[model samples]
Target chain A: MDAGVIPISNTQLALSVILVLITGVISAALRLELLKPLLWGTVRTYLQLTLIGYALTYIFNINNLILIIVIISLMCLVASRTAVRGSPRAGRYSMLLGFFSLWTSTFLVGTIVMVLIISPEPWYSARIAIPIFGMILGNSMNGIALSLERLFSEVKSKISEIEALLSFGASPWESVRDCVKEALRAGMTPTINSLMVVGLVSLPGMMTGQILAGADPQQASRPLPVVVMLMIAAAVAIGCLMLVLLYYKKLFTKEDAIAHYV
Target chain B: MPEFFKFDQIEYHMGAAGRTVKVSSDLEEGSILVIKGPSGAGKTTLLRILARLLECDKGQVFLQGQNWLSFTPQLWRSKINYLAQKPAVFNGTVLDNLKKPFALKIKKDMFNLDEAIDGLRELSLNENLIHQDARTLSGGETARITLLRPILFKPNILLLDEPFASLDDNSARSVMEFLKRWLENETGRGIVMVTHNDIYKDISGIKIQELELSEPGVN
Candidate 1:
């Protein structure tokens, strides 16, 4: 092993220490009124990350396709649920839709880019699967959160106009026309910006990690960058598309009766 | 006549400038009812309750002689036009703003754009203004955009909460005149307005009734 290279475990430990120091400074500066929440957040973040690290160690040992899918599906479900809960009146069905849309869209596109185009992987295996899937899930999670919250609040704040539309003989779509447009705009803006700033502003975390593990900067960055790029673009596209689906799936029941479900 | 919109002994409670104002009133179909009182009189609250925007502690609102609580809020709201003083005019061209309300499915097949434009012309607004962003116009202009919005929906009742309060004298006169014609065309569409400024007080053709938010209910 090269002395210049650090083990992944040591690097992970270094990250945890840095995070604690950063939290200590931020908590002190903000002088948070709710110390309990801050404490909980700190403790929970540490425990969650540690638990995931341990769990992945076991999961990575298994080579079953069914197991890989089951684990990823669980991750996707959790991410989607978290996304829906952030919105007011979002429904349980929205989780299924958001999870399916985000996962399939990004996963399909990410695989195409990862294997065929950029760093070729051997039939969607774990070493490649874990990191790429993580990137997709993370971006999709943020996108879903923003769009859901924005869509709900937009409808709520402009409620008078919505009522006016209803009175005007507008269908539900007419009432939420601007809301769809605005939510899409809000949801996609962040991912669009990150894409715009990829190499210029700073080295992304994944790329940095890959390089720390003695991988060449250019070579190590190949798959990860392609993955991030696709994930971000897909995040925007999927976020916009899924929110609309989430709106339809979560907002209305089978009877054409509309409620603030999502 | 099938009552387009009706409220029967409805009670509403909402914070007005800090204090909660309680209102209990009822109105019949096609009747021009005025909610008259000083500032912070809970007039808007009563209007909001009927409009289904403000959920009350306890009460019943009937639209088209049907219990309001029975139907979904969206269905109930679609049947009534609730226009506030500060109309939400998007930062888009006037055509976009005017055509904005038509995007709803309920109003999709219900409105005529040519008639809407003619209605604009009736308000003394130019056709060219339609191409400009609505924000470029004055508050009165914005109010007109909102007023014309319900024209597409063809709501059974128009709930105006001081629709013309901020307009200058000439604009107010023009707006009221436009409203007069619109009301004439708006058959079975009851006009329920709340205002301290009685700009339409002098209009002799349409009957008008005013009620103050009195004791125990007046905030």
Candidate 2:
């Protein structure tokens, strides 16, 4: 039987609209005011994913290194800007610094994984590089945003305690050490928790996708371990870099005093 | 003239409006600068500006013939300390709180445990309290410990905002006596204590600077 993989035609895909329609109906029945957003989100998701599918197909066919680099850079820029939105009080340079952190960590971790473990032909092949970079960048962006938001909010709420420490002649770093530790922990906890129940509790997106594409189950799950490891490395790198930069940029002034937001 | 710590036409913005308060004074060695006002007269703001926690909108602060603006925050901070009204206690024992200041790179002096205990004794806190958790202490005890911990560094200037508000009459009096003796003995050490109450009225030799809210709308 050809039941190992089930392909969906345009008719089956069109039938998926019923699922979204059901959600919109429920929202209207409940007076949740979510019907508008639900409809818009459904439309956008369909259109965007379709566009991305076409774009990916073209990029993969061309296999030009320059186009891949441009796409990757655009991904980093978008991810960094999204991360910076959570830290509104962060300085003007935050977008630039955020880009640097996201790019460096994702690139470094992604390159090492692709070079050593995956070892795909033409090493920087778009098929392998783009997806791997996407996963690393996406996870690290969340971590960076969470860490920055936590650090800034903690400093604001605990300004008096920070000042108390400063009054004792403690440096800016010493004053905010506790908050920094807490923020870093918060950033890494989600990634670590996912690692705890990878295959047992959930199939995970990458492995599920591979299996759905008709890859052998054993082969499908092979890269999941490396993906998780790369996630941790990228997340830690981004979180640490964000903390260091945020401490220098948002937490302190030119005179090394606590910034006005704090 | 430069030997005295000077606040030259210092102005701090209280809000978006034209609401601003100005304070110009010179704090000489061994002098007590008592900033007197009701609850919302920008008294804490004045002390914060002095502590370098709040930057003033105008003017400059000079200490010992040098512009404090030119000094590093570490240098300015080590010389001038600010005590909050409610006081802040970290998650640790009293001894741990007292030892933290010694960890600062600028504070190279050894942690003087005996001196800390004796100072706490002056504030009616027993030496045994040093081992107890700081967060579990009462309001008065926390205030005393907060005051005691920073003085161990022997900062040149103490910017105290309602240091005695949390204490009762007797405790406040005892604390005042201890502070008086400490100030009299230490020639260059000075204090700027702000209070809504006149509890410190009996203490002599303090230069009173009464503040009035510039904006009628301010709370």
Candidate 3:
């Protein structure tokens, strides 16, 4: 047993199954019908995390820069795909725009944190780089999805207002400027709200995990502020990139008119 | 001699049912063209297409013999204004809503409070309404204010969709009369509208265009 740390064996992990058994029993008693989803979710989470854990362990040992880049690229690609699927009306350019924005913003912030701030030995160390990049991309993906969804929906619902601005000789950008602002603001709300209540209401996972693993409370809290700031920057960057790449013209016809469905 | 405004075979499709609409029309200087139709006939859609808000699957719109698309959207809209059926009242005073058009690049004139008051009077709205919050205004007042605000721009063409849909008979008459006079005084100006009311039926010198959507062997 490592000092100040407790590692769970397979037998100990099996004991944790009792919690799930109790939940399933409650679900059955209530006839909640949530048991299937609960079991499925638990099983899926275990499998996914275990697979990723193995992959990370391999990458960390290999310590090859190219492998790290490939893994990061894969993460960005998957996140972009999720964002594009979430925002259906973002049109044909959604995938490309989503990919570009996620990759650009994540790498920009990830590089800054890895090279400048953390300055880990062998700068691209998988331990620090992977987790940092994952957090940035994960949070930024949610913001991008939310903003893109809001932008398209707002434009669809408020087509008349937008067109009114256009008919008054306002350009396309001028017409939907308010919508863009609103979407960006909406995207930022989650991160901003989380930041507001970070330590008071709930301990963030990273900070809690560091504390549990015998890191000094002060040292663990030191990176919290920086991590939160990086998340916000990444979110804003991805949101703005999506906004810039979106074509307001596509929402209209050749005659410069609004479309029924965006 | 090119017509002031010309559209040929303007078409649009709606929903999964693929219900389609096709329309063609022309307007000369000082002309009033009324678009009339039943629900789902795409009357508003046609006006939207003409206004460049909605795209026509297949069609051509010409402004003074040049393709409408040739002009930038802002330039085209400067010449042709589209008023929605339900006007959106921004979060501000009535005066703010009225003055919003001036914020556009094409509007070079300064805001004239007196002119705006006079315009409001023509719609039977009180001069004091200018200071009132637009979001708090009644539906009829909102419609009147929306219609009047764009007149300040003095566009060559005005495409209105059900402008009178929210107004009382008296207010509708006042607006109709004001529009008639404005058309007469403003030379080469035109109006195209989709309406469900008979307020304009007796108004002399106005042409009506109806769209038929559902009946077999009819259009």
Candidate 4:
């Protein structure tokens, strides 16, 4: 049996069909014509993950290091999209800066630890590397999204504080520096809190799965708890930096000008 | 006269509390502009227009013979300080507010920390308050500190929009007297403050320009 295979057997199919019916009923009660889009998104997610999972299984069998790197790059693109919807037009250069700052930091640090520090295999396998990359990327995407939204609204709402600084002869950077810091702080707080209570509260998903597969509980859990911590910490630091940099770009123009959006 | 500061047929759109207003006025150099109306006469707009913080639907502001057409707004902002009716304090200490102008590399060479303390004294604020968090200050203290920050920078012109609205009689009188004296000594520099101090009736030799807001909005 494959470590990560989740086959849509008869019982699973029945459950999925029921879920679809319930979704339709909920949409109709809300008077929203979004049942089809909802189904489409779910179906897309299922099909996409299924194909990618099978493809990655083969790539992992081969144990090709180059293939793993390519997949990680593709995941970075997906992470960037999740961070900012229609981002470049909203603020030019934010998309690229956010994408690089987030994906590169988290991905590089995560890959190094998982591959170099702990596993020390012949080559990094896609099945393990890709999934780990996805986990880190997903958490980073959420962090970036929350920070970007809060950062902009903070700037827009506190136009007075910003203008007060400007009117008192401060530059755009000086005026908005504190707002940007608060925005990043809001984004990173959740991940930091989760880290504080990780092992005491519950056994994490990776550790549990490895134990289920007949691996030594202590051996399986040992490396994973540390790796998980590293990925999350990387995600937070990278996510915070990306948002602050993006926000700076959002507030100012080529002339070091503050936008009079409000 | 190069009209040290002038608003040539300038219009203004300003927001206060939750209400917004639009007004238009022309400001001359070295004018002690008094904006008197019952309440909500868009007096702040007159000051914001001069400061270039509030937008004007139509018209131009000129300072030192330029129509304000090309100066980088940051550079222009470095020149004029607008004191608001209800002053806002930033999240840090009073010293952060005082060192506000030093943030701009363009204005760094011109900033003097000593001048900031002196200005605080002139506004009757305790020198020790410089290290205090802004949130700890009262409405009156905050207002004076707000006034103190801009004055120390000594912008080319001062655009005060009802700065005394939140102060007591003694504090208001003292603030105005100190400001008036400072304006008198600076050549080619101007102070245009909006106030409802009807008692001044006519302050001796002060250039008082009055504007009544009763005109219809331009469609």
Runs with alpha carbons beyond 4 Å of true place in candidate 1: A1-55, A62-128, A148-172, A189-240, A247-262, B1-5, B15-31, B37-41, B54-79, B109-132, B148-154, B168-174, B199-201, B215-219
Task: Order the numbered candidates by DockQ, best leading.
Answer: 3, 2, 4, 1
Candidate 4 residue-wise lDDT, B1-219, digit = tens: 665555665554444453334444455555566666645656666677666665566677777778776777677776777877777777789988777666667667566768877878888888898899988999889888888777777777788877777888888877777777777777656777777665345346556667666443531
Candidate 1: tens digits of C-alpha lDDT, residues A1-262: 5765765686786687676666767777798645556667777887898898888787777746677777777887888787777753555556766777767766676666556765634555666677677777777787877877787788777765655555444456656778888888777888888777887986777888777877789896786576667666775576567656557434433323235333
| Candidate 4 per-residue lDDT over residues A84-185, each given as its tens digit | 773434554567766776777766677676767657555375656766777787778778877776777788788777777777656677778877888888
Minimum summed lDDT over a 10-residue window in model 3 chain B is located at B210-219
Q: Which stretches of candidate 3 lie over 4 Å from their true place?
A: A18-34, A223-256, B9-22, B37-39, B108-110, B201-219
Evaluation by TM-score, superior candidate among 2 and 4: 2
- Residues B1-219, candidate 1, lDDT per residue (tens digit)? 545555655554445434545554545554677888766557777776676665666667676678887866666666666776776776578777677655555445445768778878888888777788777788778777778766556667778888777678888788777766666775666778887666777776866766677555442
* Cα deviation of B136, candidate 4, in Å: 5.2
- Candidate 1 is scored at a TM of 0.68
* Higher-scoring candidate on TM-score, 2 or 3: 2
Error of 4 at A182 (Å): 2.0
Q: In angstroms, give how far residue A250 of model 4 lies from its true place.
A: 1.0
lDDT score for residue A170 of model 3: 83
> What DockQ does candidate 1 score?
0.26
lDDT of 3 by residue, A1-262 (tens): 2565657798887788778888998999999997888889888878989999998899999988899988999998998788778667656678788787788788877887788877889999998889888888888888888777777888877876776787787877777878877778777788777777878887776877777787788988876555656565665566555544464556665555565457
Tell me the deviation in Å of residue B150 in model 2: 1.7
Q: Model 1 residue A26 lDDT?
A: 78
Model 2, span B1-219: residue lDDT tens = 456677778887765565677767777777777777655668888898888877887888888888987878888888888888877777789998888778778876588888998898888888999999988999888888888876888888888888888889888877877777777776678888886556667777654444444444332
- Give per-model TM-scores: 0.68, 0.90, 0.87, 0.73
